[model samples]
Target chain A: MRKGFRTDLRWSDVTPKEKWLNRRQLMAGAGALVLAAPALAQGTAAPGRYSTDEPPTSLEDISGYNNFYEFGYDKEDPARLAQGLTVDPWSVVIDGLVDRPGTYALDDLLSGVTLEERIYRFRCVEAWSMVVPWVGFELAALLGRVGVQPGARYVAFETLLRPEEMPGQRGGTIEWPYREGLRLDEAMHPLTLLATGIYNEPLPKQNGAPIRLVVPWKYGFKSIKSIVRISLVADRPQTTWNMLQPNEYGFYSNVNPQVDHPRWSQASERRVGGGLLAPRIDTLMFNGYADEVASLYAGMDLTRDF
Target chain B: MDGAASLNGALRRVPVWAVCGLGLVPLAVLVWRGLSGGLGIDPVKTLEHQLGLTALQLLLAGLVVTPLRRWTGVNLIRYRRAIGLLAFLYAALHLLVWLWLDLQLRWSEIGADLVKRPYVIVGMLGFACLVPLAMTSNGWSVRRLGAAAWQRLHRLAYAAVLLAALHYLLLVKVWSAEPLLYALAAAGLVALRWLWRRGRSGTVRA
Candidate 1:
């Protein structure tokens, strides 16, 4: 009975051909609508709407699709098989160029420390990427507590080597006892975190359980997993990938799109789970953290140094 | 001897149409599952994994036909066409899932991915080799091409099998034991074929 909402209709609005094209257009429009509707609804939402300053990316996605060489060389193998590993009763042997040198249990190291969540864009050397909300204190903070000496120019991290735990170690696809290294300055960067947990949970076995390093500016592999030792050395330490293919993987291993990997292009990265139509996002210099960390390698040629 | 005779009678009685339909069952099931939303939430991953596994299964089945014929003297020649066609069906499914769900009709991206990813390149090469084998499976093509030429062209299936295995291996960021085992099995089949050829030629010369 209320005439207030009465709508005006024209004869042209109901044409059969137009209706058919409209249906086709509606079908075509559905894809864009699916992607856009949620974003729009959440834009000017209620007071209790959950939000975080962190980017819409997660460490779970990154860690879930890891290629941990120590566990296995397969991308999904670590996720499938690393669950067999025992992460508890783990201890890290910290020595060399530090004032205090002794073994520290993983729990003891993690118990009293304050953990903070920092959202980071992780770029893999293979040119895929994800946003990760990593929970850990700065590596510099931990190093400060350990008291590093002036002569320490590099920091080397080593993964555990028990063939019983890591079955891949039984066969020699790579030299056993995987190792990764970082320059002293790189290790001391504020963003570098010795991560022990992610997404408010203990690190998954596949994602370098017990402990791992997170150097955000570099390629993902530079962040070593299942670390058993951290040694401060006076010389540059030999990294596993660098040792394997010196030309392809350099010691620095910064995320530089211009410097392509030998087998693949590094100019762009596919955000996993992004539907087929989502164009690969162009990779940024230093993985979009260039402003914060590029000063560390101000003059060095990244292509050559890498 | 009685069982063998019955099997021969069964083979003779079973209509070719029925065998063809049976051969198509795997593809039909896949299509049904794909349309019914039974392939799980991530359709692409589900399809990719299923097609990949099926491709491996069909390849192994094709390999087994030869050894089985020799070992049991079962005359498995009748099954060879069906097995090869099934292999092509799985391979076609694999390519379709990749093109539709993974690449999504982005011709440029598809082209780029095929060129950029070594695994994709190898997979395309394997699929290319399968086209000829599938086309020439019919009796008409065999007769038109002549038996000698037909045999020569169909021999490309061996190369297709190897390429498919390589494609699987190269796809993963790191090597897994499962795929490696498949590669070893494929390699063993190829080795057996080579050994059989050598033995046959040696016997002929003697």
Candidate 2:
């Protein structure tokens, strides 16, 4: 597996004259492939079109700063404590409202899928944002494989909750076995990705190792990590954050500049890696994925759902 | 000379400059860590939070000065100016971090935060109270306003200290012992001042 295989194609496939003329331009764009992590060399993946022109955040920042409260409450806790977690031999139980209801090994479940790079803007309910380059397949493809039943109107996710591994669960900050769900339509949205890795490497334990959901249009918390159970249900499942503070965290939890958090304004968000003195940009409707996801909630009151 | 020696010998020997320098150690360490990439993933947020915490701690220290003088006769009068100024400096830096770094002078967002966020409002109120106190901290302002009026004006420290403590309490998501510790310190200092004043009035009557 040659690293930057796509980049090699740019030069070898081009005419000598053309390559010479576009050398500088090609070198600058070479950055996209050059910084890719080792697993990205698998060459079965394609770059996503919706990716931002903005530079990808450093992996240290992306993996180091996280909000998996199952590990601990502090942002740095996940990186520090999650190292003890064992991820191999992982499997997920896909039950409820699915015709193919059974436990499946993660590798066997994703065996036929092609991983793709998706650069997305992740907005936290706490008013901080990050641009992440995640590698995964669409949730729709996985659901298709599972064979959803007609009664299923939602997709519920559950996180691993071993107190010995996830020490934070010993404390009552949030309920054990953190759960989240998306509307059936939302679960099937092409934009919704079930990420298995990031920066081309297999997902680190801190970043929800092996598997996680990445719902770009929703708040970061809505995208549950280290998922162990994925249930297709007829009703919306109780989410961890929403259950903890119903007024502050909603089930939909879409990124909206208009609706403010109870304690803070959501009009703008601090970009995590944007450095000191970096101007906070105004948050976008649906975190700038409005065109793709807005119609899903066309007539519904976003404020109420939010 | 003999009578003056008996008044407050310990206070005369107070290491005011040494204490102020010691107070600055945390800020220096934070800057050093920030420059060397030791402040974890988000250095700016870390810096902002640390500065705010330092400022709140300094405000608590400043509040304890008068009570210490009355109760223990270890007057920190000479170092009070430095302590107050240092608190103000850190508070000012905290505000600058939020304004210039966090919000990037996004006035509308700031206005919204002030209106919607009670913690921000309380924090700003605490900062506002410190402004007049910081302005009148020096000898010239003390002389110009007359010592009696100056002392009366600076009593706003009590309100500022309480507001700052409340601001910190409200800012935290969970009810940790850390914020409560600061709040208790502020409350104790305020209570000590009240007890000292009542005792002094009893002495006057006697």
Which prediction has the highest DockQ against the true structure? 2
DockQ metric for all predictions = 0.10, 0.56
For A210-300, candidate 1 gives per-residue lDDT tens digits of 7889888899989998999999999999898888778878999999988877666677775654433334677899888787789999899
In model 1, state the lDDT of residue B5. 63
Which parts of model 1 are misplaced by more than 4 Å? Answer: A1-66, A69-88, A107-113, A125-128, A167-172, A243-248, A273-280, A299-301, B1-8, B11-46, B103-118, B172-176, B191-206
lDDT per residue as tens, model 2, A247-272: 98899999999998888888988788
lDDT of model 1, residue B25: 79
What shift in Å separates residue A266 of candidate 2 from its native position after superposition? 1.5
At residue B91, what lDDT does model 2 achieve?
Answer: 94
Looking at model 2, give its docking quality level: medium
- Quote the positional error of residue A63 for candidate 2 in Å: 1.0
Among the numbered candidates, top TM-score falls to 2
DockQ, Cα level, model 2: 0.56
